[model samples]
Structure formats: C-alpha cells, structure tokens
Target: MQSMTGFGRAEHADDGLIARVEIATVNRKQADIHFSLPRELTALEADLRKLVLRFISRGRANISIHLERVSGCDDSFSVDPDRARALETAFNKISDLIGRPVALEASDFIKAPGVLTFSNSVWDVNEAEKAIHPALETSLKNLVQMRKAEGADLKTDFLKRLNTLETYSSVIGKATSNVVERQRELLHNRLREAEIEIDLNDERLLKEIALFADRCDISEETTRLASHINRFREYLDSSEPVGRSLDFLCQEINREFNTIGSKANDAGIGQSVVGAKTELEKIREQVQNIE
Candidate 1:
C-alpha cells in the first residue's frame, strides 16, 4: 500500500549548471501532473511527464524544475544594437525639436524596452536529461518512501476500523437470527389482549408471518458484507494500485450494510448495522488517500 500525499526535492550541479527539482502530490482520483520548467527544457515535458507517471499512478502532482548557471558562465544579456541606434536617433530628433540638449545616460538606454535582451542558454537535450534525470530519480525515491511510511500508518487505522465493522456485523447477525420468531410471539400476545380469537394455525396468519420473516431476514446482506470485507483485506495486501478498487468495495460494503439496516427490523440489529456503516465510512475516507 502507498499514500497519495508526499513531497520530495533534489538538486544537482554539473558542468557550470545547477538543476533543482521539487515534486509534491495530493490525493486525487486520477493521475494529473503539472510541470513548471524553464523554456529551454519545455520540449522535454513529454518525457518528464512519462517519468512522473511511471512513479505515480494516482494523484495531483506539481513538479517544478529550476536551473541556474554557475557564476563563471558567459553573460546572458546583450543589447540590441539596431534598436539602441533607433532609440538614439529618436532622442536626438526630440532634442532638436525642443531647442535644447536632451542628455540621456547609458542607464536610460540600457533600461529601455527592447534595448536589452536576455539570451536563453542553449541547451543540449541529452545533456539536460543527464543532469535532470538523476535529480528527478532521487526526488521520486524520497517521495515514494514518504508515501509508503504514511501508507503504513493508514493501514493500521484501516485495520482497526475493519475490525470494528466485523464486530458490529457479527452482533447484527446474532440479533437478526431470532427476530422473526420474537415478532410472531409479540403479535400473538397482542391479538389475545385485544380479545381477537383467531386460530393459531390459520393459513392467513402463517402466510403473514412467513412474509414478515422474508422481509426482515438480513442473512443474504450479511453474507455479502462479509465477502466484501474479506475482499477489502485482500486488496490491502496487493502491491498494485488499489485505490479505485478499494473505493468500489467500500461502496458495495455500504450498500449491503444499508440493506441490512433497512430489513433487520429489530432495534438491536438496526443499531449494529449503523455501527458497521459508521466504521465502513471511515474506511472509505482512508481509501481515498490510498494508491
């Protein structure tokens, strides 16, 4: 088992370049990856996405990559000579029109829009991959480790809740066993108190009691609930992604519990069903975080 929430970061410096990668994830029904990469690395988005998907099957993940050149690297900013010349000519014309010298400092032209252009570092795809892949691998390893640790904790909680559910299911089954007989006895006593003398073996009374028994019996629901619980436990032991599967199982469990609650008729059995459903609800919430 693994959780869908974790964070990891790694940095690597090589050949006058420093690369940093950070990855964060939260629980989601499907894998959704968003990346923040420098323009030079944008073309590698597909490969990066594939790498992330290989590690994470379900989550909303945010990946960010930052790259910086070492101090000794060549300058990345340059002035556009043509634009600077045009600006200078325009300034001289303005000065002639004003009939006075319009003094402009180098700082003015340097700061002008389009005068100074930043040159993006040329990147070799192979070199960039070599530098970034290791950092990404390290980050993913840490993320998985954290997720596994959290999954262990979640597993403990889920097991406790499952035990509670099982206990309540057992109680409900026992309470339901004699509920029909008890109801029939109570009905007979009420009829005698009301002075309604009917044959104890009347065909109508027997049919009504039989119908009541059928309506109140929750054996089928309890059996299915047990099956679902066992399947849920098996899924917990699985190594593959089981979040969706466990979620579906939780729905099935809740459905069976709801049927039992509605049909059990006896107060004690109803209460037990409620308790079991409560535990199952908690398990469902935890399953949402599993992957």
Candidate 2:
C-alpha cells in the first residue's frame, strides 16, 4: 500500500524551452486533480490529469507546470515598437508636467513592461508533451518509492499492534470462564445475608445466569476481528492502491473492538479490550493516509 501524501517534480530541458512539472499530493477520500499551467498549456490539462491519475489512484493532487525559453532554444530578441512608443510618450508627458527636459534612455524602455519580446520557434504541443513525460515519470517514481518505504514501515507497526489485539482477545476469552458461576455465587450470598430464602437449585436461576453470560460473550467479535486483520494484511501485499478500501476495513475492525469492549464486563477483560481498542484507533488514524 502507498501513502496518499507525497511530492514529485520533473523538468524537461529541450530545444529552447525549459518545462517544469511539479506534483504535490495529500490524503483524500476520493481522487482529485488540480493544475496550474500557462494559458497556452491549459488545453493539455485533461491529458495531464489523466496521466497523473494513472500514477495516483487515490489522493488530492496539485500539478504545476511552468515553461520558459532557455538560451539555446531561441536566443532571438526584439523590442515591441508599440510598447516602446507608449513608454516614451509616458516619460515625455511626465517630464513636461514636471517642467524639466528628461531623456528617455534605453534603460527606461527596457524596464517598462511589454517593451521587450522574444519570437519563439513554432513547436507542436505533442513534442513538448513527449519531452515532459520522462521528467514526469521520474517525479512520480520518486513519490511512489517513498510511499512504498513508508508502507513497509506502516506494515511493521501494524503487525505489532495486531499481535497486541490477538493477545487481548485471548485474555478476554480466558476471563469469561466461570464468570456466570461467580455471579451466581455472589447473588446467593447476598440473598442469604439479607435473610431472603431463595432456592439456588432452581432451573430458572441457571437459565438467567447462562443468558447473562451469553449476552457478555465476545467470541464472535474476536473471530471477526481476526478475519479482518488477515484480509487487511493481504491487501498490503498487492500493488494496487488500497487507501479507501483499507479505511473501511479499519472501521470494521474498530467496530468489532468496540463491540468486545462493551460486552465483556469482567474488569480484566474490559481493561485489555480498552488497550487493544486504543491500538486499533491509532492504526485507524494511519489508515486515512494509506494508499
């Protein structure tokens, strides 16, 4: 399983353009793709989104692409005549208003916005897309590699907690033994102390105690919890994204843990269940970020 949160960046330096692609991801219940690109590249958003989704099956992803001409790609430069004229007119008007003769220098024209321009060699969007693929692939590969490392660590932590849960399940089972008999003894002693003569040999008494014990039994819950754990481990072995499904499985495990805690009334069993539940809750917290 991979983590839903990660980052990847790729740069394609080809021809006269330096195209940079950066991707940031965060934990989310569903797949979401957002992009920041120049207006010219906006048309490619759908294709980029599809490519990103292929690498990331679950997460909210932020993708940013920036393109700029590098020195070797196209070095041709020119002045925008209209913009230069506009800037010169503004400077001359300002000088006249200030009652002074001012020289409109080359620096002034160069400093003005839109005064300088470059003519890029016409290029197809498809070629740029191909060049970006390698960089994009590298970035995603790095992100997934990190998530795999993290997932391995998460698996280790889960195994330790699962063992704890199993140990507590056993304790609950052991603590349940003779519990109804003990409750019967207590009730009999209390009645005798109160000077109330109640027949302990009645089948009704046995039936009542047995019914109470059955109500408190957590065996079914424990078995289901075990099954869920096994299934979860199996998911970790697969290459596919499992964040959403694992989240549901974690909830099921927590529900089972809660059920065991509520039904097991023996103090030892209850305490153990509480501890196990705490561990499960921690595991569940991590599940939200799992992929």
Candidate 3:
C-alpha cells in the first residue's frame, strides 16, 4: 500500500547550470500531474509527467523545476554600440547648441534604454535535460518512499479499527440470539396490560409470532457482514492500487450493518450496530488516502 500524500526535493549542479526539482502529492480520485517549469524547459513537461505516472497511479501531483546559471560562467556584459553612439552624438549636439561645455556622464548613457545588456550564455537543451533528469529521478524516489511509510501507518490504523468492528459484530450476534422469544414476551405483556383475554397457545398468535420472527431474522446479514470484513482484509494485503476497491467494500459493509440494525430490534443489538458503524466510517476515511 502507498499513501497519496508526500513531498520530495532534489538539486543537481552540472557545468555552470544548477537544476532543482520539487514534487508534492495529495489524495485525489484520479491521477493528475501539474508542472511549473521555466519557459526554456517547457518542452520537458510531457517527459516529466510520464515519469511521475510511473510511480503514482492516483493522486494530484505538483512538480516544479528551477534552473539557475552558476557564477564564473563564460557569459559577459556588452553595450549596444549603435544605441550608445547615437546617444553620445545627441548629447554633443545639445552641448554645441547651448554654446557651453555641458558635462556628459558615462553612467547617464549606461542607464539609457537598450544601451547596456548582458549576453546570456547559450543553453544546450540536451545538456539541460541531462542535468534535470537525475534530480527529477531522485525527487520521485524520495516521494515514493515517504508515501510508502505513510501507507504503513494507515494500514496499522485500519487493522485496529477492523478489530473494533469485529468485536461489535460479535456483541450484536450474541444479543440477537433470543430476539424472537423477547418479542413474544413483549407481546404477551402488552396484552395483559390491556386487560385482553387471549389463549397463550392460540394458533393465530403462534402464526403471528412466527411471521414476526422471520421478519426480524438477521442471520443472513451477519453472515454477509463477516464475508465483507474478510474480503476487506484481503484487499489490505494486496500490492496493487486498492483505494477504489476498498471504498466499494466499505459501502457493502455499511449496507450489511444497516440491514442488521433495522432487523435486530433489541436495544443491545442497536448499540452494537452503532459502534460497528462508527468504526467502519473511520476505516473508510483512512482508505481514502490509500493508493
């Protein structure tokens, strides 16, 4: 099992370029990949998405890539000679028209638009990709490790709650054993209180009691609930993605518990049903984070 929540980051430096990658993931019903990359590296998005998909089958994954030029590179600063010369000529003309030696500062020309520019070092796409791929691989590995650790914790929690559900189910089964006899006694007491005379061995009363017992029988539900629980445990031991499967099993379990609660009319059975339902709900919540 693996969880859908985790974070990882990695950095690599090659030649005069540095590459950093960060990966984050959160639970989702389907697989999704979002990337934040520099314009120069936009073409790598498809490859990055494919890499993430290799590790995750379902989740919302966010990947970010950052690249920077290291110091002491061959890049240099240069002045646009044409723009600078034009500015200098204009300044000379202005000084001549004023008939005074107007001072012109080199800083003024440097500040002029387009006068000075840095010559960025040419980047080879293949080299940049080579530098980024290793960092991306490391990040993904770390992410999977974190997700697996979290999954182990979630599995432990689920097992504990499953035990709780089993305990409650056992209590309900015991309480339901004499449900028919108890219902019959309640009917007799009601008749006595109403001062009505009816034969305890009347055929009509016996028939009614038999029908009531059939209506309230929960043995089938209990049997099905036990099967569902066993299937759920089997899924937990599976190595493939089991979130959707576990979610479906939770619904089945809940349905059986609901049937048992409605059919078993004893107060003790009702309380046990409530406990089982509570534990089942918690298990469902935990299952949502599994992949």
Candidate 4:
C-alpha cells in the first residue's frame, strides 16, 4: 500500500548548469499530473508524464523544474555585438543632435534587452533530458519512500479500527442471541401489569411471538458483515492500488451494519451498530488517501 500525499525534491549540477526538480502529490482517483517547466523544456512534458506514470498509478501530482547556471559562471552569456553597435550609433547620433557628447558605459548596454543573453542549454529534447533525468529520478524515489512510510502508518490505524468493528460485531451478536425469548418475557410482564389475564399457551399469542422472531432475524446480515470484514483485511495486504476497492467495500460493510441494526431490533445491538459505523466512516476517509 502507498499513500497519495508526499513531497520530494532533488537537484543535479553538471557543466555549470543546475537542474532542480520538485514533486508533490495528493489524493486523486486517477493519475493526473501538472508540470511547471521552463519554456525551453516544455517539449519534454509528455515524456515526464509517462515517467511519473511508472512510479504511481493514482494521484494528483505537481512537478516543477527549474534550470539555472552557476552563480559565477559567465561563459554561457554572450554579447550581441551587432545590436550593441547599433545602440551605440543611435546614442551617438542623439548626442550630436543635442550638441552634447554623451559617454556610453558598458553597464548601460548590458542591461538592454537582447544585448547580453545566456544560452538556453535545454532548448532541445536531448539536452533537456540530459539535464533533468537524474534530478527527476531522485525526486521520484524520495516521493515513493515518503508515501510508503505514511502508508504503513495508515495500515496500522486501519487495523486498529477494524478491531473495533470486530468488537462491536461481537457485542451485537451477544445482545441479539435470545432476542425472541427476551421479547416474549417483556410482553408477558406488560400484560400482567395491565391486569389483563390471558392464556400463556394461546395459539394466537404463540403465533405473534414467532412472527416477531422471524421479522427480527439477522443471521444472514451478520454472516455477510463478517465476510466483508475478512475481505477488507485481504485488500489491506494487497500490493496493487486498492483505494477504489476498499471504498466499495466500505459501502458494503455499512449496508450490512444498517440491515443488522434494523432487523436485530434491540437497543444494545443498535448502539453497537452506530459505533461500528463510526469506525467504518473513519476508515472510508483514510481510504481516499490510499493509492
């Protein structure tokens, strides 16, 4: 199991160029990725998305890549002599027209647009891959590591909640074990209190008790609920993505709990059902974060 929430970052420096990659993921039903890359590296988005698919099957992933030259590296920068010369000439002409000589400083032209430009090292697909692959791989590995660790914690929590549900299930079973006999005794006590004398062995009274027992029978529901719990444990041990499957099982489990609550018709059993439902709800919320 793996969680869908994690963060990772890595950087690779090569030949005066540095490539940094950051990836963050959150819960999502499908594999959805958004990329923020320099314009020169935009063409590599498709390949990057494919690479992410290999690491995760479901989540919303955000990937950002930043490329820069070493702080003191000036080799990648070049002056456009043609543009600089044109600018100098234009400035000189303006100075002569104003009848005053104006001195041109190198800093003045350096700040001009296009006067000095750094070469875009990752302008090609091959160069972009060379610059980014190492950082991207490292970041992805870090992300998976974090996700796995969180998943372990989630599994532990889920197991504890499952134990709670099992305990509640046992409580409900015990509460309803002799539900019919208990109801019959209560009915008899009520008749005596009302000063109504009636034959205890009357066929009509016996038939009513039998009907009540049949109506409140929940053997099938409890059996199914137990089976669903077992299946849920199996899913937790699965290596593949089980978020959707576990979500579906949550619904099945809740349905069984509902049936048991209604059919058992005992206050103690109903309270146990409510507690089990609360635990199941927590599990369902955690399931949404699984991948």
Candidate 5:
C-alpha cells in the first residue's frame, strides 16, 4: 500500500555539473505528471515521464529539474561576441554622454548580463541523461518510501474504523433479531384497542402480518453488508493497489446500510444503521488518499 501525498529531493554532482531533482505528489484519480526542466533538458521529458510512471500509478506528480555548474566553475558558458559588440557600442555612447572616454575593462564585460550564455548542452543527450538519471531515480525512491510509511498509518486507522463498523452491524443484528414477533404483538394490541374483535388466526390477518414481516425484513441487507465488510478487510492487506476497489466496496456497503435503515422500522436498528453509514463515510474519505 502507498499514499498519494509525498515529497522527495536528490542532487547528483558529476563532471563539474550538479543535477537536482525534486518531486511532489498529491491525490489524483489518474497519473498526471508536470515537469519543470531546463531548456537543454526538454528533449528528455518523455523518457523522464516514463520513469515517473514506473514509480507512481495514480497521483498528480510535479517534477522539477535544475542543472548548474559547480561553484567557481566557468566551463559551461560561452561569450556571445555579437552581444559583446552591442554592449561595447552602448558603453561608448555612455562615455560620450559623460563627455569623457570610459575605459573598457575585461571584468566589466564579463560581468555584463547577456554577454555570456549557457552552452548548448542538449547537443549530447546521452551526457545529459547520465547526469540526471541518478538524481531522478533516487528522488523517486525516497518518495515511494515516504508514501509507504504513510500508507501503513492509514491502514491502521482503517482497521480501527472497520472495527467500529462491525460493532454497529452487531447492534443492528441484535435489535432486529425478533423484529417480526414484536411487530406481530404490536398489531394484535392495536386491533384490540380498536375493538375490532377480529379472529386472531383469520387468513386475512395472517396474510397481512406475513406481508408486513417480509417488507420489514433486513436479513438479506445485513448479510450483504457483512460480506462487504469482510471484502474491505481483505483489501487492506492486499499487495496491489486497491484504492479503486475499496472505493467501490464503500459504495456497496453504504447501499446495504441504506436499505437496512429504511426497512428496519425500529429506532434501535435505525440508529445502528446510521452509525455504520457514518463510519463508511469516513472510510471513503481516507480511501481517496490511498494508492
């Protein structure tokens, strides 16, 4: 099991270049990857996306990659001669405006913006991949680790809630154990109070009671609800991703509870059905974060 929310970062330095990769993920129904890469590395986006998919099957992942030369290293830059000429012309105009000749210093030109540009590193795709792949893989591994850790915690909470659900189901079962008999007694008392003096064993009276018992019966619903709960417990221990499956089971469980609530016709069973539904709602909320 794994969670949909996690963060990871890694940096790799080689051949005077440092590659830094950061990944953040959040809950999403599908795998959605967004990347922030240097222009030189744009060509590698497809390959990088494939790697991300290998680690994450469902979530919105934001990946950022930065490549920079080591401090005090200047080998990755080239002077733009045309830009330098433009700067020189601008400097000459500035000197004239001041009515004095301004000295042209190498340091001044080197410090000027747009005079130097990063080299065309994309010319060698293999080299760029070599520098980035290690950092990217390490960051993804870290992200998976964090996700699994949180998933363990979520599993614990799910088990606790499942226990609560079972408790409510038990209460409903007990409350409805003799519901038919109770209803039959209530019907007889009502008939007596109305002074109808009808035959207790009349075919019409027995038929009406039988119909009422069938309508108020929730045995099928309770049985199905228990089955759904057991299926959910099995999913919690599954090795594969079960978020979607668990979500579907939650819906089924809620449906059973709804049926039970409506047919119960007793206050105690109705309250138990409500409690079970409440627990199922919470489980559904947490299931969204699972992967």
Candidate 6:
C-alpha cells in the first residue's frame, strides 16, 4: 500500500543552470498534475507529465521548477545599432535638460536591446531531455519513499481499527442471541406498568413479537459485514493500488452498520453497532490515503 500525499525536492547541475524541482501531492480520485516551469522548458512538459503519471495513480500534484541559467554564458551578443542610437539620443537629451554632463558608456549601452545573449542550445530538445532525467528521477524516488512511509503509518492505524471492529462484531453477535427473550421481557414490563392483565396466549401479542423479531434480526447484515471485512483485508494485502476497492468496501460496511443500528432495539446491540460504525468511518478516511 502507498499513500497519495507526499513532497519531494531535487536539484541538478545543468550546463549553466542549476535546475530545481519540487513536487507535492495530495489525495484525489484521479491523477492530475499542475506544473510550473520556465519558458525554455515548455517543450519538455509532455515528457514530464508522462513521468509523473508513471509514479502516481491517484493524486492532485503540484510541480514547481526553478532554473538559474547564467546570462551571456554561451554565445556573445551583437549590438542593435538602432536601439543603441535611440538610447544614446535619449541619454544626451536627458543630460541637457538636467544641465549636467552624462558619460555615454558601454554600461549605459548594455541596457539596449540585444546587449545580452542566450545560447542557441537553450531551447534544444535534447539538452532539455538530458537535464530532465536526473532531477526527475531524484524527485520521484524521494516522493515514493515519503509516500511509502506515510502508508505504513496509515496501515498501522487501519489495522488497529480493524481489530476494534472485529471485537465489536463479536459483541454484537453475542447480544443478538437474547433479543427474542428480551422482547418478551419488555412486553411483560410494559403490561405491568399499565396495570393491565395481559393474556399470555393473545394472538396480537404473538403476531407482534414475530414481526418485531423479523425486523430486528440483523443476521443478514452481520453476514454481509463479515464478508466485506474479509474482502477489505484481502485487497489491502495485494500489491496493486486498492484505494477504490477499499472505498467500496467501506461504503458496504457503513451501510450494514447503519442497518444494524436501526434494527437493533437492545441497548447493548445499539452500542456495539455504534462502535462498528465509528471504526468503519476511520477505515473510510484511511482509505483516502491509499493508492
């Protein structure tokens, strides 16, 4: 089992850029990615998306990247005569207006267009691909490790709840046996409280007890809940991502517990059903982390 929430950060030394990437994931029903990268790296988006999908099955992921490529590191820039002339004229006019002498220097010209340059290889598909692998691999591996650790904790908590559920199910079973006798005792108490002579062989009493017992009998729900628990644990043992399966089983368990709670009139049975429901709710929440 693996959790869908994790965070990872990686940095790689590119030709002139130290490429940094950070990934954070949160649980979702489907795999969705949000990316932030430099303009020069846009061409590599598809490949990065594929890589992310390979590692994650269900999560909403945010990927952020920072690139620090040295300016004018590759090829020398050429001056644009028109841009330099315009800047030079503006500088001279500004100096004249201020009644001051301003030096027309290379530093002033550096602000002109095309003064700084970029490598032709900056947009190279191959270069981008090459730089991608290292950072991506590092980030993915760390993300997987973090998710695994989180899943281990979730598994421990889930197993404890499962044990609680098992104990509660046993209590409910034992409580179920005396329900018929309990109803009879309740009927006697009610009649005495009303100070009425009750007929032991009353047809209405017989029909009502049978009806009540039929309504309160949670054998069907108990059987189904046990079967669902078995399947739930079985899915957890498998290698495949079982979030959906676990979610489905949680719904089944919740439904059965709800029925048991409604059908049971005995205080002990009701309390046990409530315990089972509480554990089932915890199971449901833990399932959100599974992937």
Candidate 4 has an lDDT of 0.87
User: How well is each residue in 1-291 modelled by candidate 4, as lDDT tens digits?
Assistant: 899999989999877678899999999999999999877678888888888888999999999998877787554777789999988998999899999988889888877777877675434557567768888988999999999999989999999999899899888877877898998888888889999887888787798899998898887888988898899889888888888988999999999999898898888888889999999999999999999
Error of 6 at 7 (Å): 2.2
What TM-score against the true fold does each predicted structure earn?
Answer: 0.85, 0.81, 0.82, 0.82, 0.84, 0.78
Which residue pairs in candidate 3 have backbone atoms (N, alpha carbon, C) closer than 3 angstroms, thus clashing? none
Worst 10 residues of 3 by lDDT: 117-126
| Runs with alpha carbons beyond 4 Å of true place in candidate 1 | 80-126, 199-201
Q: Cα miss at 8, model 1 (Å)?
A: 1.3
Candidate 6 C-alpha lDDT tens digits along 129-192: 6666689778988998999888888888887888888788788878877897789778878988
**lDDT (Cα atoms) of all candidates against the true structure:** 0.85, 0.78, 0.86, 0.87, 0.87, 0.81
- Candidate 3 lDDT, 183-278, residue by residue in tens: 888888898899987888988778889998898888888898889889888887887899999999999999989998888877888888888898
The alpha-carbon deviation from the true structure for residue 138 of candidate 1, after best TM-score superposition, in angstroms, is 1.4
TM-score of 1: 0.85
Clashing residue pairs found in predicted model 6: none
- Which residue pairs does candidate 1 place in steric collision? none
Q: Compared with the true structure, what per-residue lDDT tens digits does model 2 show for residues 1-291?
A: 788878888787776567778888888888888987755556777877777777888888887777667765556777889998888888889999999988988888767866875555334587567666666767778777777888788878877877887787777777777566778898788879999887998777778777888888777887898899889888877788887777798889878877877776667777877887888888888888887
Q: What alpha-carbon RMSD in Å does predicted model 4 have with respect to the real structure?
A: 5.3
> If the candidates were sorted by their lDDT against the true structure, best first, what order would they fall in?
4, 5, 3, 1, 6, 2
Sorted by TM-score (best first), the order is 1, 5, 4, 3, 2, 6
Q: Candidate 3: what lDDT?
A: 0.86
Q: Where does candidate 2 stray beyond 4 Å?
A: 68-70, 78-124
Best by TM-score: 1
Model 4, C-alpha of 226: deviation from truth (Å): 1.2
Clashing pairs in 2: 16-73
Model 4 TM-score on a 0 to 1 scale: 0.82
C-alpha RMSD of each candidate structure in angstroms: 4.0, 3.9, 6.3, 5.3, 4.8, 5.0
In order of listing, the candidates' clash counts read 0, 1, 0, 0, 0, 0
Q: Which of the predicted structures, 3 or 6, would earn the higher TM-score when compared with the native?
A: 3
TM-score of 3: 0.82
